[model samples]
Target: MKIDELHQVFLNYPRVCTDTRKIKPGDLFFALKGDNFNGNEYADQALEKGAAYAIIDEEKHTGKQKILVENVLKTLQNLGTFHRRSSKAKVIGLTGSNGKTTTKELINSVLSKKYRTIATSGNLNNHIGVPLTLLSIKEDTEIAIVEMGANHQKEIEFLCSIAEPDFGYITNFGKAHLEGFGGVEGVIKGKSELYDFLIANEKGVFMNADDPIQKEKLKDYINKYGFSTSDTKYYQIRLVEANPFVVISVEDTIMGSQLIGEYNFTNCCAAVIMGKYFNVHLDKIKAGLEEYVPSNNRSQIIEKNGLKIVLDAYNANPTSMYAAIQNFTKIEGGTKVLFLGDMFELGESAHEEHQKIADLAKELDFDNVFLIGQNFYEVKSGFKKMKSFDDLKNHLTKYSLPNSTFLIKGSRGMALERILELI
Candidate 1:
């Protein structure tokens, strides 16, 4: 069936499902295929589970309730684009190397105070996830915040065409996805695709004026709003301190947050600026920021058995890892211990980046540092290094460091959060 016809069917059964196990009655199911599994094989199961329609690309799966399409993925994308164009909600497309998920959540929390808002759920900011998020927007949604993540060139640009955002924001380009994007320069060019879209379409953008690269790249864009510490022309906010929790002063009001790390200052500032732009009351914005607590091993502070722990193992790269360590240095207390794991996706530069982190850890004033993973183990460092989690687990089980402040961080694959169980 054509897109318009499918859209008509969607208007009746608006709920879209990808998994047969989660199929609800009167829901439209899309049979998405991957290398390991073909979703077409489950079309019959979806129909049995009461799916209104099962969209599939395979001709063999065609039936009374099964609709055959040239490509199921493209059909889903086109349908999402079609629905977005028809939506009354103002779309805000967000992309970046680091803090995209956290920034997106912050913006959503602040904006939802006044407007009927919907945002990308969790870290569902990829190709399939973007379309799914757009499809989830309802008619009553006044604002939609879509987080876009890219590991290679033109991924953001392609997602932009689907989301068709009226406003855009890039968190900051960092040494992330180095293997997919060639290097730091490639990271910049890849992320700036959002800027390219907003500029060409004459859309508004929210930016960090404190960043020199952001200012230089957006010099020619006319429609832009910024937040900074010193620039009075835009919204001004200052960081009071980040001892364990972040405290900030904005609009003559002091706000305390549950989030730790000075690097999160920019993330919080961006949310405040977004709230102001939408004319949300300063009190409501403060409430939103204050109520939010970091989760999913991202900058979470936990006190257990007299030991204060900073769990930041959700993701890591050279940029974020450095900032986490630098923030750890400022916290005043007992013996500061760091359990740094290998950062992934660095490609050929993995060894150098791991060595740099090892060297930096040596120079810092930490009482103990333990490096985990193969990359860090290969690096020539004096600190206690482990090639795997079992090695670190065995050592930590024997050695007990009481009343110490622990900073545990690494990439997602490393699963450094497991250290909490050992401790």
Candidate 2:
């Protein structure tokens, strides 16, 4: 069936579910396939669990209340594009290497102060997630914040085609997904695909004037608005301090944020600029920024036992890891400790990247540094290096660092957050 026909069915059953376990009454279940599992096989289960209709690509799964299509994923994406085209909500497409999810959340919080807003839930910023986010927009939604995450070339371009955003933002390109993106240059070109889309379609772009790369790349794009720390033609926000939490001054109005790290200053600024552009009251914008608390292990400060721990174990690449370390170093307090885990996705540069971080830790000379994961173990640093989390756990169980501030960070695979239990 065509996408329009599928959209008609979607109007009746507006709720869409890709997992049989999450199926609810009146949900339009789309069978998505992955390397490890085939969602088509669960079509019968989905219907039994109260799904109104099951969309399947496999002909063998055809049955009552089942719609067989050439490709279920493509149909779902097309339906999302159709819904977005019909939506009255002005969509804001956001992407970047680092801090995409946090920035997206901040933008949503700020925009929702004055408009009925719907944002991409959590880290749902990939191909499947982008379409699902678009499908979540309702008639009452005044603004839709869609976060698009891409690792390689053209992924953002494809998501942009589906989202068809009226405005766009790229957080900042960093050393992330290096394996998939080939290298830093590939990362720049891949992420700049968002800019290419916005420019080609004549959509507005929100940028960081402080970033030389961003400024240089968009030098020719006239429809760009930006925020910067120093004086610029666009918005200017000053960073007050980032001892533990970030405080910024916007138009002489000092706004305090729960977010940590100077790196997050730009994320907060993006929200403030977007809020002002949308005419949200300055006080409301401040309230929105102040109310947001970091969770899901992304720059969260936890107090356990006697130590203050900065848990940034959600994920890490070289760029973010270095920023976190630099921020931790500037905090004046008792002894500073670091639990650095191996950065992932560096590909052939993994050894060199790990060595760079190890060398920095040595240069800073934090009171104590524990490096975990295979990459770090091979760095040949004087700092304590553990082959795995189990090794770190054993060491932590035998020792304790009291009255010290700790920064724990690594890629998601390292599960560095688990160190909290040991501490």
Candidate 3:
């Protein structure tokens, strides 16, 4: 069927679901395939679970109340693009190595304060998720923030084609998904795909003027924001403190926020600058920044058992890990301890990057540092090293520090947040 026809079906159904178990009545289910499972196999189950219609790719699954497509994923993407074209909302296509979700949420919060806004939910910012986020926007939505995540080259380019955003931003490229992108050079090339799209379409980019890399790469058609308004081309902003939580000054306004990590200062700044650029009132933008809080173990400060824990274990790469460490060391109170795990998907650079973090810990002279994961264990550091969470758990059973502040961070696979139970 044509995209227009599919979009009409989507208009009537209104809701979209990819998971069979989560299908609701009157929802459109798209059978998406992946490495481990084929959603096509569950198309019938989704329909049986009250889906208004099942869009399937396999001919064998096509039947009553089911629509067959040449390719379900592509068709769903087309439908999403069609829906986006039908709406008058301004869309910003956001992608980066880190801070994609946080930045997106901040932008959504700031925009929603004055306008009907929709954003990519959680970490749903991929092939299937991006399309779904676009399709989820209502006709009344004044703005939509489409978060895009890519582990390899050309992925962002492909996603941009689907979302077709009017504007774009990259939240600083760093060492992430190295195994997939080849190396640091590959990371720059991959994330810059957003720039390619915006430049090609004659769209504007919200550039971080303080970031030399972004400055050098995006030298044209920019919506700029960063420290130092002395330049006039940039919006002035400053990092207050993220030891307890992120605080920032957007020009004359000092917005105190609940987000932690000085690294997050830029994320909040992006929202404020973008809000102002889009004509959101300064007061409403500040309200949005002040009201927002970080969750899902991404820079959360938990006070328990007389110990303050800075938990940022959502995901870690070389760039983000160092930023967290620098922020923690700057806080000169209580016994400072470190609980860092492996940085995954670095390919051959994994050992070197993990060692680099270990070296940073030793150089910074934290009271005591604990390293987990095989890659970290291989590093020859004086900091306490453990092979796994089980090993860390066993050591924690015999030792405990109650008064010190702990900084816990690692890749998602490390599940470093679990250490909170023992610490």
Q: How many clashes in each candidate? A: 0, 0, 1
> Model 3: runs farther than 4 Å from truth?
222-230
TM-score for each of the candidates = 0.98, 0.98, 0.97
- Show the colliding residue pairs in model 2: none
Writing each residue's lDDT as its tens digit, candidate 3 over 164-270 gives 99988889889999999999899999999998998888877887877778888866554434433345667778776665677787767888888877778778878
Judging by TM-score, tell me the better candidate of 1 and 2.
Answer: 2
TM-score leader: 2
Tell me the spans in candidate 2 whose CA falls farther than 4 Å from its real position: none
Using alpha carbons, what is the TM-score of model 1?
Answer: 0.98
Whole-model lDDT, model 1: 0.92
Write candidate 1's Cα lDDT for 257-312 as tens digits.
88888999999998999899999999999998998877899999888889999999
Q: Tens-digit lDDT track for model 2 on 1-423?
A: 888898889988899999888888989999999999999999999999999999999988898999999998898899999999988999999999999999988998888889999999989889899999999988898999999998888899899988999999889989999999999999999998888898998989999998888899889989988998875787989999998799999989999999999999999999999998899999999999999988999999888888888999999999999999999988766889999998988999999999999989889889999999999999878888899999988898888688999999999999988988786
Whose lDDT is higher: candidate 2's or candidate 3's? 2
Which window of 10 residues has the lowest lDDT sum in candidate 1?
213-222
The lDDT of each candidate is 0.92, 0.91, 0.88
